[model samples]
Target chain A: MIRVDENPEDPQTVNELIEILSIQLNEPVMKSTARLMIIISLALNKKLTFTDLLEITSLGKGSLSNHLDKLKEGGLINIKTVFSGMGPRVLIEITREGMLAYENYSKILKKLLSH
Target chain B: MKETPMDLSDHLKKVGKEVVRLDFYLLKRAFGVYYATWAAAIFTLTILSYISGITEQSDTYLTLYGLLDIGVIIVAVDYTRIVFRKAHMLSRLESDLQMSKSFKTIGNNVNIGILIVLIVMFAIIGTNIFPGDLNSLLTFIILWIVDLYVYMVTRISFGKVQPEVILAVGTFGFSNTASCLEFLLTGNSVYSFPLWLVTVIGWSISSLYSFYKAGEIHSTEIGESGSRFS
Candidate 1:
């Protein structure tokens, strides 16, 4: 295969290189709509609750609940439950790992523009 | 107690949209890192060859270079397979979305770190900055093992064991061992085969053991979270 630097500015070559890079950096968690929105919101807010996530994203109860579970399992978000007067309410926060992934994703977006 | 049909449909549509957006974000990130690394590797190799005058035009050198090129191509193909597999898993989660948040977050972070390390390795090797010595080989092996371990831990924690994760671990193991053997065959005495071989074997064994342990943890918590959601 021709090396990348040989024709770095060639549009076709650049496109191929971009294609390969896209494959390597793609994250499974980032592909879910609910997860992405929650991540963006969490990044903006630093922390939120399940109800807050639902209200912000306008996701239904089942969809929000299911996506939140997946995000939690993936370590993208953290849930801290506290007992209030009525019942236990959970506060969701993006973990350090999640923030890193978000940052990485943001970096990728910047690259695409430069390319 | 009951959700209207329109409500359910609207909810599913929203979920689908979220999945698409996430896919776009991931694809962009993966491609960006990959291209930058490729460009840097090629540039470094070209510069090193020019400086060292190491381009011995012998038949033996040409044959060995061809073999190395083939090996790299194989690795690239395997990497593509991994990318596709992860993409497929994400698509499935769009519908099921049953995976754990912690696992996904951890997996993404690990993936990014590994890619960065890989780019660095490519640059270092291409530049011939670090001779193929025992210390360098040991560092490569240690990093490979760590990457595999992190991958396995993420998989087990997520409760969704995609074949891609196992494939990645296996591929990294095979490549690391093969590279070491290649060094040995080249008569490089910088590394002791006995010690490096043992380290590789130990890491491989421990990685598998941890994988099983992770599986157990996942199974235990499978349905436990469902009740909380309800």
Candidate 2:
């Protein structure tokens, strides 16, 4: 039976982990967990309603709208309003850029966890 | 700048936990809408059947029922489309994350369960095995089981007890269960159409309550993690 250690104390391994962490920490959008979550959700869902995002994030409307605007400005997401019998609803879709970002983050996180 | 590898690992784990929490929260809410829609369909059908039988106006009931059936179908199809689209999006992801697999599994199982239950319920009704008009009682029993099953699934999957869902559905189920027990005790036509109608309305109200509770979560900012931007 093999026992798994929590954090390998090898100097090189630690340095490598630290370097990966540092690189990710330098990214502005990746600095915040909230933004990362939004991207992950949008990436996985492609598109979701504003209310659906609100429910997912558990954030206030104003704050969520602000995050959406930032994502839109970053070319990570697009926000649109469509009208139906139930009235107009906002739809948030992840852009190709956003999906790429999500993929990168997920890869980094998985690598970090493995170490 | 002085963070150790262990510290960074903890941070990454925290973020991952928060993301998973939010995803599960969204899923639970979606299930609420699903349950409400199904309850509405069942309630509407029950009411239509009762009205047609009482009024003896087959023509008007047929027209109204046909239109309502169409409406229900449209709504259900719309929900199916949304769910499928989301699943497709997840499938398109390059990395085979464990979280994604869990999400897809839950989605597939829930939907498949719905189809199976619908088909079985329809089959039972079509058979008309009961001697008298006790078939309606079977429908109520099935609905009660649905409520209990939902409660069980939510508890098992999310690891949190949704008391409101259980409470609302429980009240209706309790009343109907009592009705069934009473009928069983005395071999009589006590399970009348009016009683079934009342139980159907109760179930509908319970569904509305579930919808209200589910929708209520998003209206306000919850927890510090939710308000990180603010």
Candidate 3:
């Protein structure tokens, strides 16, 4: 929290605040629009597979995998990989941490911007 | 801070709503398919009615409906196929979700009660329509009851509220309302045939759309999560 005496409305203060908020976001949740989309999409639907996400997000192979790795590393989601007749299937499920982070992020964003 | 901060509550609200919307993605798509099927069904019925000489109605309108219905059903199917062929993942997701426990949930006691009530209401209307012909009335009632079950099953195939299902239900409601009015007015000449035409059209579209989508979904390979995206 920035001190009121420090002029919360200052550009520097706002930039710092933005940075702070960005840092607080879940590892898989921040900066990239695709990451946020992934989290939001997972939060909305409890579970999704690679193909499902591919169809929904229209994200390419490398980009989706990169975001998934970050999310997976941050303990935001669980990625399960296995084989099927069509080839490989990757299922992505949002963890409780990821869900809470997403909800909190949405709330905080609304709060920050609502003024 | 100088300029008034843009109010984004509405935008936030929209984003929040998008989550809900995404949740119903497959359902909405399924609805388009439903409309296509309903058109085909109505066309078929009109042709059959015309052939049997069941009513003194204009054969031209009925024949026109058949042609239009067939055309629309074919187009909707092709559109669905085109968009969804590469996106087989969507079809799989829809089918898997539909086959899940939610589909079975509708078969419980409460729905059955509602089903019974609907059956009774339609039966009264059917009986009134056929007048002294008890056999025809019975047949009409039985057929409607079967259709009601189909309607319910189709509606719940993917946890309800597929756009197609809603349209189909609305169509049914329209026809029934017309039937009730017809019963009050004269109750003798199948005055609700027009409404029935609308009803079958709606169902045929709903049915074909749902069927193909579900069919596509079922075609996907299902097993352990694959290494590719799992």
Candidate 4:
């Protein structure tokens, strides 16, 4: 049998092992459906509105609004109100915190994909 | 072959339904912006007119202002009705987001254009490009152009009734700037160029703050998936 070392300090083996561990740690949080929805929506456009989210996800108004509220509260989105001909409209955009979360999540996903 | 034709029809029907839904959502989102802007414009104009002595309680000026006020109110109420009628079909937050983004983009472009023209008008007046009477006439012409441009752009961009909301707010700023400058140049009023400069500085600072805030918000929503907050 080929010689094998069980020591965690084995450089090549340790690196691989650490990478595997990282993937496991990152996957569940980043890969969650709610996170995915937000990520996909923002990725497709630099901004998303409530109605746009509904169109993209085909989710009901209340459900989508709840998700948006959670995202906003989580510091994952920013909403602004502007006047139009019809009424006061809310514009939803992503925030730096949201971007960081997505980035970290993506790194985890990448690690998972690579392994 | 029979199955293929039927499947295509079903797909088309689904698409048709989706389009209708999207249209409704867009209308409501647009309406929200309209009402807010209208209210803001009226409030700002009333205050500015009072401060500038334009509201001297003259019959003509008062009548003119009253008519303008009534017009905006009518527009706002009518647009609100239209939006509410279609609101039920919207049933989606994302749709509103998309419409809002489009409106913001259009608004930014229009705002930039208005600022540029105002700057040009100021430069021309300062340099005596035309006599006083002609200058006033030219100013009116520019105002009309600005109004027309804002109306056309908002209507085209929103694809519904024209929302004069943004135009109203912008017009307030433009008028304020012009009136203040005119007062400084002609009346040598207490309000100096420095004050005007300060106003510009204030605008620039606030604008930057808003932009930074928007960037921060955008990044958070995107969450590293290269997503954009709408």
TM-score of chain A for the candidates in order shown:
0.67, 0.73, 0.68, 0.64
lDDT of 3 by residue, B1-230 (tens): 22122323333334444333343444444445545544565555545544544655577867875676567656754654433321222222333223434434434333457557765875576456654645444544554564565455545435454666666777876776665555556654343456677787777766676666654543442112111122
For B1-230, candidate 4 gives per-residue lDDT tens digits of: 22232332233233323343333334434444544544444454445455445335767767876677667656755654444323322322222324344554555455557657866876686687787667665655665564454444445434554223343435445655665466546853322333334333433343344345334433443223321212
Angstrom error of the Cα, residue B22, model 3: value is 7.3
lDDT at B99, model 3: 40
Model 4, residue A14: distance off in Å is: 34
- Per-residue lDDT of model 1, residues A8-83, tens digit only: 4534432344333333223232233446556655654456667656655656789778777877777778888988
Top of the candidates by lDDT: 2
Please state the error at residue B94 of candidate 3 in Å.
23
Tens-digit lDDT string for candidate 1 (B1-230): 44333343344345434434433333323323333332233333323333334445667765765565556555544554444344434433332333234555566556567666766765566676665584567556665755574455435333466443454455445545665676667754333333334334444444454455434433443213211111
**Mind listing the fnat for each candidate?**
0.02, 0.34, 0.05, 0.00
Candidate 1 chain A least-lDDT 10 residues:
A21-30
TM-score, A chain, model 2: 0.73
Q: What is the TM-score of chain B in candidate 2?
A: 0.55
Q: Given candidate 2, what's the lDDT at residue B173? A: 70
